[model samples]
Target: MSKLSLAETAELSMLLEVSANIKPGNIDRFHDYEDTKFRHFLASAVLARDVFERVPQMTLGEAMYAAVEHTNGHTGGNTHFGAFILLLPLIKGKGIAGACEAVLRTTVEDAVRFYQAFGKTQVRVNREDEMDVNDPASITMLREKQMTMLDVMRYSSETDMVAREWTNGFALTRKAADILKEKDGADQIQEMFLRLMAAYPDTFIAKKFGYARAVSVMERAQLVRAGGLSLSRFDEECILGGVNPGSLADICIAGIFTALLEGWQWDC
Candidate 1:
């Protein structure tokens, strides 16, 4: 009785049709197919879920849409296979019923939109053509360019109190703090941050996302002797002074791990 999200259900229905034994438009053979055919289809469907998750920028919805748009194209075939891999994890975590529905709903909408774009009547057709949306190289380009949505999502979902404190310490704007609150917001900010980091890896962006700062003997003494360095101290001395984040990796690491240790879990 695991609850399924709206998206997961949509994916499954398309999967059933896509993996069928009978050819397209062959209604009778498809209908009369043995129960075993369906059972196996169910199994393959599970595999597809796992595939979707591992794909870099593509979420289940994006991948499913890609599948419907270009099922015959090389990219579409990649998505088809990717969908199978995504199914396993979804099934184990969410029950079969819920997951299937999400999958079906997501995929069906994409199927319709794909047909409408070309002035064609929407059907359960697999076009498999080469569209920019279906480009297999999109994933590679994202990674090489360091602009992955997956990474954005992960950073957004995984960021915690310590990370927040760190950002606040850096004197991030109030809007920036709010942006870090949820996954979508975090993803948006992270995307921008990634670009900043790529351009200025030796600066603030890299420090926040990638590294830590070390406690100096004098800095440690201040903590022990005068109640630790406040984030304000770090902000005034570092942020305003334009000190690079790489120089503070140790401190950042300590703070991040401390926050994680305080108990954080991956987003659902």
Candidate 2:
């Protein structure tokens, strides 16, 4: 049994990963993007943990909405919307696979709240439709279709990697957990991150760049993992290439948190 609170567990996960200097295209101790900083992640983790720890129960949407709303309030920008989306289901000890099913099992009320929560965050997607929380019909539509949050995620899963995780049972995150056992310290985090980027081909990069560009980055990442390219050299190149495997990074955060709760000894 671990001694850390869920909040502490969440915070430790954020701290350990963000303090690491080498997360390829994202902000870290070594680099900062113009809009997102390492500190923003730290703050988002604290806010997310606060929402996850609430008692007397919160609906999934309530937890997500509160977490994103509070996170944006603190950071004045979007920091970890994808992370919050992927992670809120796991905060209560549902293994990644179980959480995937759990998400699809959510209620219509949960869908409405999730839509409402999206309205509060600074997420980058275009939201011009029935998802508007203010519209009464959206709730009716949700009820009519019996659309759970995962159902909503499935609609985007074909295009969005994070949404795909909900539909795919968080297979990539589980793969990272297996990888975590083989490496140590910051290297453990970086290695898991790189391998995940290699395996998943980063839909964030695809969305921002093109699909071909994302595949090229994936191939390069696989080479670095295989030692055909040096980690530092490829890390730099990834940044310069504007390839950010952000969704993988978020899953890495959740994987690390789960590992820590299970008392993983990285230095072993």
Candidate 3:
């Protein structure tokens, strides 16, 4: 394998997270989500290579939304929405803080393109009283509000953990990276995943099954991880229960990418 740069490492880390069974509550080599299967994720990863490679030359929002569109065009499902959001600024030769700053600095054009990209990726986002991407007037309102991509994220940061990452400078992922750097090898992925899940209930689960169920999963993670308990049944139950801890998984991937970029060898 060739020596991967930070952007390349971050892109591959998403694929590695998707391929790892030990991450728990994720579709990996051992299990599959009913809607999104193994092939879909593999396809998503393959599609991401060009997007990741081209990101440096693109603006933050441009690269972010375009990658989402590109990935979903191939997979027909939300594949790397969170990864795309997180990796955009990182791949632009910015540190995590720089990435957050870039989000705040995005212009109305950036917001517009990202809004359009929503139609393509179709990532499951909260639309309670908010306008849908399909609503023709949404773009008009987007222009009216003169919102930046960061403004859009701020609108949803209250409930969406992924959005919070963008608005708050990816605090969780950064913290998890610190933990990952303290540890070593592939085991750190599982450890970081659990730590993240336990600390914060998975946003995907909360969106699907309400916040209480999400909290239960977090509690379960606490117990399962504390004693070094068997994760086999937990993994089985999470999948069977339709509990894909996607946000946590996404954050964990960020942590892994951080570790790899910082010269920690991933035990593949």
Pairwise lDDT winner, candidates 2 and 3: 3
- 1 or 3, greater by TM-score: 3
Clashes of 1: 49
Instruction: Name the weakest run of 10 consecutive residues (lDDT summed) in model 1.
Output: 23-32
Q: In model 3, state the lDDT of residue 244.
A: 87
lDDT of candidate 1 over 235-257, digit per residue (tens):
34543433423212212222222
lDDT of 2 by residue, 1-268 (tens): 4577766766677777777667777777787766677777777777667776771277677777787777787643777778777667766445575576567667777787787777776555534534555666767788889888878888778767877877787776677777886655656887778778778778778777867988998898889878898878887897787677777777887788767655675544
Top candidate, metric lDDT: 3
Q: Is candidate 1 or candidate 3 better by lDDT?
A: 3
Please give the clash total of every predicted structure, in order. 49, 0, 0
- Residue-wise C-alpha lDDT for candidate 3, range 1-268, written one tens digit per residue: 7888666787678877877657677888777666778778888877777888887678776887768767775533787788777777666644676676677778878878887887776667665747677776887888899888888888778878887888777898798788888766766677778778878988889888889999999998888978755788788788778788888777777767766777776764
TM-score of 2: 0.87
- Winner on lDDT between 1 and 2 is 2
Give the C-alpha lDDT of model 2. 0.73
RMSD of each: 21.8, 2.9, 1.9
Q: Which regions of candidate 1 fall more than 4 Å away from where they truly are?
A: 15-24, 27-40, 54-56, 59-268
